[model samples]
Target: MPRVADGSIPGGPRHVALIMDGNGRWAQQRGLPRTMGHREGVRALKRTIQAAPDFGIECLTVFGFSTENWSRPAEEVSDLMGLVRTYVANDLKRLERAGVRLRVLGRRTGLPDDIAAIVERAEQTTAHNDRFLLQVAFNYGGRADIVDAARKHLDRVLAGETGEALTEDILGAGLSTVGAPPVDVIVRTSGEQRLSNFLLWEAAYAELIYQNVLWPDYGPEALADVVTQYRNRDRRFGGVESATARVVG
Candidate 1:
C-alpha cells in the first residue's frame, strides 16, 4: 500500500460514500427501540470519520436520512432529527479542531428552524478546515437531487442565459455535491446492495461494495477492508486497459 507522510494509505480512494443502513433492524434484533440503534450509529459515524484519513479518504459522504424516510413513523422521524442535533452539539467542536469541514447535503427548506440553524452553524464553523470533508446527506434522495439540479438549470436558461448551451457540466454544477470530488467508491452496510437513492449522479462510476456488518457496528477496520477491496479492483472509466487501471482477479 502507498503511504503518505503521515503514514496514511495514500493509494486508497479520494472519496467514499456510505449508505448507513440497518439501524432499526439492529435495534430490533436486540429487542431495543429503533431510536437506540440510531444513537449507536452516530457513535459509529464518529469513529469512522476519525479513522477515514488514515485510510486515504479525503471526503466521506454518509446517508443519514433520506427524502423517502418521511413516510416512516413520526416518532422515528423525530428521533432521527434529534440524533442530528445531539451529534452536532457533542462533536462539532472536536470536528472543527480536527480540521474537518462539514457540509450537510439535501433540502433545507423543509427542515425545522432549529435544525436548519444548527446545520448552518456546523457548516460555517468548520468552513475554514481543509484536512478533510464530511458530507451528511439528510433528507436527501438521488432522484430529488437530480430534479433540483435540473430545476436550477432550467431557471438559469429561462433567465436569458439562452446563449449558454446546456451541458453535463452545467447541470452538475447545480448539484448539492458540486464542489466535492466525484465519489470513488460507495459502500452499503448491512449487506445491502442497493444505492437506495443516494448520490446517484456523483456515483456514476464509483465502485460499489456491500458489507455484512450493520451500520452501528461499522468502524475503521471495516472501512480499511473496503479500501483494500477498492484497491484490488480494476477501474476503467469507459476506456480500455490503461496504465493506471489495475488488473486483479
Candidate 2:
C-alpha cells in the first residue's frame, strides 16, 4: 500500500494485468537485434514492479510468454527462455529482497526441468511475503487455464465432493490466482488492442487501456498515467440503473 508522491488518491486497483508486446517490431524499427528489445523489456518490467505499489497495485499479473509464443523463431525463443532462466535464477533474490511474491501461472508438465526447479524455489522463497504478488504468465493461455479449472472441478465432482452444479466460486478456487483479487484493469503496450489470450475469466469486468508506447519504453511515468486513466473510468460492470431506479419507476 505504498502511496503516490502526491498521496491524494487513497486507493486504486489491487490487480493489474499487462500484455507486454511489440519487442520484435520495436527492434526492427530501431534497426537493432530483437534480443536487445527483449532485454530492455525486462528492464521495463523491473521498473514497473518498482512502481506498482506507488500506484496502489497489490497484485501484478504480467503476460511474460504465452503458449503461442513458442511458434516464434528458434533463436528468439531460446533468448526468451534464457531470460526466464536469468530472472528465476538470478533476479529472484532481488524480488525476495523487495518483498515481492513470485507466482508462475501456467502449465508446468513439460517445461525444462531447470526452469521448473527455479520456479519452485522462487515460489517457496516468496510464499510468506505479503508485500506484493507478482504473477508471471509463462506457457499460459486463458482458454487452457479455464479448461484446467473445469477439469479440476470435474475431478472433485467425481470424488463425490459436490453432486450439484458447478458454481463460479467452485471453479475459481482452482485458478492460479484464486486468492488474489480479480483483475481491475488490463493494460497492453505497443499499441496492441487485443487481449491476445491473456486473462479470460478474471477480465470479465476489467477496464482495458491500449498504449502506443512499446513495452521497453514503458516506465514509471507510463504506469502513473495508466493508473490516472483508470481512476477516471466509470466501472458500472453491467447494470446501468441504480437501486433508486425502482423507486423512480
Highest-lDDT candidate: 1
- What is candidate 2's lDDT per residue for 1-249, written digit by digit as tens? 335576534446678899998787888899999999999899899999999887778899999988888899999989988998887777888888889999999998767898788778889999988889999999899998989999998998899987868789888888877888789899999987989889999889898999889998888898887877776676767888532233222
Q: Model 1, 1-249: lDDT tens per residue?
A: 668677666457889999999898899999999999999999899999999988878999999899999999999999999998888999999999999999999999899999999999999999999999999998899999989998887887898776677689988998899899889899999997899999999888899999999999999999989999988777778888741345322
Task: Name the top TM-score candidate.
Answer: 1
Off by over 4 Å in 2: 1-8, 241-249
**C-alpha TM-score for every candidate:** 0.95, 0.91
Worst 10 residues of 2 by lDDT: 240-249
Query: Where in model 1 is the C-alpha error above 4 Å?
Result: 6-10, 242-249
Considering summed lDDT, which 10 consecutive residues are worst modelled in model 1? 240-249
